[model samples]
Target chain A: MNAIIRSTARCLRAGAAAVYLPVRAGARVWSASPPRRLLCAAADLQKDLGAMVKKDKVVVFMKGTPAQPMCGFSNAVVQILRMHGVDQYAAYNVLDDGELREGVKVFSNWPTIPQVYFSGEFVGGCDILLQMHQNGDLVEELKKLGIHSALLNAEKESK
Target chain B: MAETADHIRDKLIEELAAVHVDVEDTSPNRCAASFKVLVVSSQFEGKPLLQRHRMVNTCLAEELKEIHALEQKTLTPEQWEKQKSQ
Candidate 1:
């Protein structure tokens, strides 16, 4: 009651613990709620994409894995790379993760599946790959990355 | 809401100050899910094809978030003029 206030002050002392307790406890109740679930979902997928790209000198985020490409465009890129003797590159199946499927487009800022990367850099998708192959630029690019293709010599011999 | 081909085209032209732009809705059902774009801008001069495409992608970032597919052929004004005359 007013006993503590009166005793401590010439007229008053501290109030009852009840008065300060509830207000201080309430203000100190900082819950620190967890981050939103939706953000984590996308963030995880983007982290996965980043890691996947970094793992290989050549990384393709396609609709399906190399063995069983689900999309024609993806299959086309896979075939082209194989023809160029790129046998050990990594390929991520965007279809497996819904977040990955969408996150990749944002990650590359290119609105297409079958996106390609070289040395952790965003290479274009199927069309650019095909064009580069036709122009004999793909072979040179791969060579710069320490990837060799006997097919380049074979094509020259055939020509 | 979904954006139309004309809307995307106008936005690209406005943003890039492109000399020429053609936006085509390539969706099988014409639902605006896919688009093919050919843009000619002096701003693209000296940029590699990847960088040129990147420029277009950046300009249409908002539209791209909603659209499912995009194919781009970016060219400088001189390249565009050469192709046209050819």
Candidate 2:
């Protein structure tokens, strides 16, 4: 049942990407003519990103989608989330959009890709995530969002 | 110009007053594009992980532009001691 929902979401995301890419490219081409037009685009991107982060409880702006990560750092994030049994998060592939790749860095005020957000708050990148996971903070964080980590049960059973 | 591990180490120590710094060029061919660093500083005492990272990011803003990857582990002096004891 959960898998079905996840696959459906994936399909929807893929469909959205198919439609969004060309439109974004067109906007870029149009904006190139005027200097002020570029500024407007940046403003619009910030507004869009403000909504994008909060759209899901867990949002990741990574180099690639969860299924197929283009970078090792991004792959590590996906694996950590998977270990916690978190499969229903939003993942954006920054590599697909040049604007997004640059926009997100400015939006988050962090000069790095593979950024993570929990409940619309910037949660640092791969290293911080790995630290949280190792130190048991990730499980607590997940619990706060009403998501019980699979590690909690595994630890109980092992004991 | 490409960033070097030694240059990064010096910058961290000077800018952040980092007491202990370990930087490794993790790129396969030693191209200096990728680095892994562990920084221990008194300045990180009260700050959270995100703030600590931001500090490093700001200090190395120029270097980061040319560098491809950076993996950082930041710690306060006390936390560094605790980890060392463990």
lDDT of 1 by residue, B1-86 (tens): 78798998898899998988999998889999888899989999888888888888788888878887787888889988888999
Top-DockQ candidate index? 2
For residues A86-141, write the lDDT of model 1, one tens digit per residue. Answer: 86676667777555577788788788798989998898998789878877899888
Q: What TM-score, to 2 decimals, does candidate 2 have?
A: 0.84
Candidate 2, residues B1-86, lDDT tens digits: the string is 98989999999999999999999999889999899999999999999888999999999999999988899999999999999999
lDDT values for all models: 0.75, 0.83
Q: What is the TM-score of each predicted model, taking all chains together?
A: 0.74, 0.84
Native contacts retained by candidate 2: 0.64
The residue-by-residue lDDT of candidate 2 on A95-121, one tens digit each, is 987767888999999888899999989
What are the per-model DockQ values?
0.59, 0.78
Recovered native contacts, candidate 1: 0.64
Worst 10 residues of 2 chain A by lDDT: A19-28
lDDT of 2 at B83: 96
- Which residue pairs does candidate 2 place in steric collision? none
Report lDDT (Cα) of residue B69, candidate 2.
84
